[model samples]
Target: MSRRIKGLVEFEDDNGAVVRYLRHPHGGGLVSPAAHAHEGAWLAETSYVEAGAVVHDGARVGPGSWVDVDVVVGARAVVGSNVHLGAGTRVGSGARVGTGARVGERVSIEPRATVTADQVVPDGATVGGSGTGRRSGYGRAA
Candidate 1:
């Protein structure tokens, strides 16, 4: 069965849709459900996801960041304030995208991969050592 891990931020009503979280000791915090879009196939309105984070379509985030879902940010990779996704852009599990480094189309980042700190990933482009070799896997780095 699928279960959620502790410390990670996830939606309580969105079928366990994962959101961003603050690292323990560093500042583990909670997701804020404010000024957000609670409909559609993505997170909506006034959210601010941080670098290396992700969200997928159909994933509902009230006012937080999506960091995990298959441990990858897909379609609606939603993000919120101060949230980090690490890597692994497989946010297809009802993502809620926000600010910060979002997962691009056909892109796959490694788990716990830091997508923050000026890491720019284009559409259909892979960033870390995951998925198939090459930048996007479907082809070579352009």
Candidate 2:
């Protein structure tokens, strides 16, 4: 019988890393108390931000999105609905991930990069950069 803490949700990755999150005051999303979500950041209902995740100011986290441990969503970045940002991933400022994208761990989405909808980003992938069109993250970063 595991005694779960009130208002706390915990998830364990395949690597045995356990992440936890608390309820967000504004949108009923799950945001870890240890995580940093700016007051200006908009967290959609049903989103989950794990411990150690940082969502900077002006960022909009879409519904059903998951920000894993140690992930940083830069200022003004827009994470699409149902997007999954794995551990150690970094989304640069002004970057945008399209809806339903599943990004693996340790991924880096550069500033102003635009990931297409429903795209699958592999682990350790580097995406977005200057001159990147809407198809950024569809392939390796130039």
Candidate 3:
């Protein structure tokens, strides 16, 4: 599917960097420059990936979403609008995270699996099944 934000989101220009808006409105302003994502990643309006969160190459975080501490959005992964990725979650390469998905802490996203909107993957849980159950699409070796 084509990549684009799909909800009520806000974009703020803080200095030269683009900052996404966290719903809680931290740092003493609705639009603060310090809320900016690291390395000049393209942050959608009202979609906030907090500091220390790494969104790598071509990863798109949709509008109205919040990616919390130390989360890693892998290359080409698509995070949908209004979705919340808890701390230490890993969205694998090419995985599609649907809108309103609530992923729990330390979850693993298998590559190429489609996470339907509003699906909740509990902490340390695995969603997709490997053809042989030996390895999920992109999850751990367990």
Candidate 4:
């Protein structure tokens, strides 16, 4: 059985819909009504996870991070402080987004990809491969 870590409060969404969110443990973060975060996920205080976002077990979202709509922060992924993950962004399992990284809208980081601390990824960019590198495009090169 899961216990209530915090209370629920209502807020108005951009579309004028009243959305409710659950406050995280120790006043860490706010989990949206439409978002799902595993118990092991560590959301620091001041972070806001938007609707449809899923934070898997062992993932840690630092303070002030903004996880936009439909974003998926994979298991064990570490999102640094103040990171802005745009809508539809996917931080693959085991990926690490460095502090203050500005990930543009719809960016997809492949599994195990590491966006070096403070890296900036443009909108629609795809970061992949077996090592740390920044490639500007939609997909990996053939």
* Model 4 weakest lDDT span, ten residues long: 133-142
Model 3: lDDT of residue 22: 40
Span of ten consecutive residues with least summed lDDT in model 3: 24-33
Flag regions of model 4 displaced more than 4 Å.
1-6, 11-19, 131-142
The lDDT, on a scale of 0 to 1, for candidate 4 is 0.82
Among these predicted structures, which one has the highest lDDT? Answer: 2
Residue 102 lDDT in model 2? 91
Residue-level lDDT tens digits of model 3 in 37-129: 434244566667666677766677788887887888877778888999998887777777889989888888776566788887778776563
**lDDT by residue (tens digit), candidate 1, 26-120:** 12323233222222434333233344443333444333444432244444333444344443445333222334544445455443233442244
Number of clashes found in candidate 1: 34
Rate residue 67 of model 1 by lDDT.
44
Query: How well does candidate 2 match the true structure in TM-score terms?
Result: 0.80
State TM-scores per candidate: 0.29, 0.80, 0.64, 0.80
Task: List pairs with backbone clashes in candidate 4.
Answer: 28-45
lDDT of 4 by residue, 1-142 (tens): 1234347766666777776678866436888878988888999978989899999998999998999999999998889999999999988888888898899888888877877667888888887846544432335323
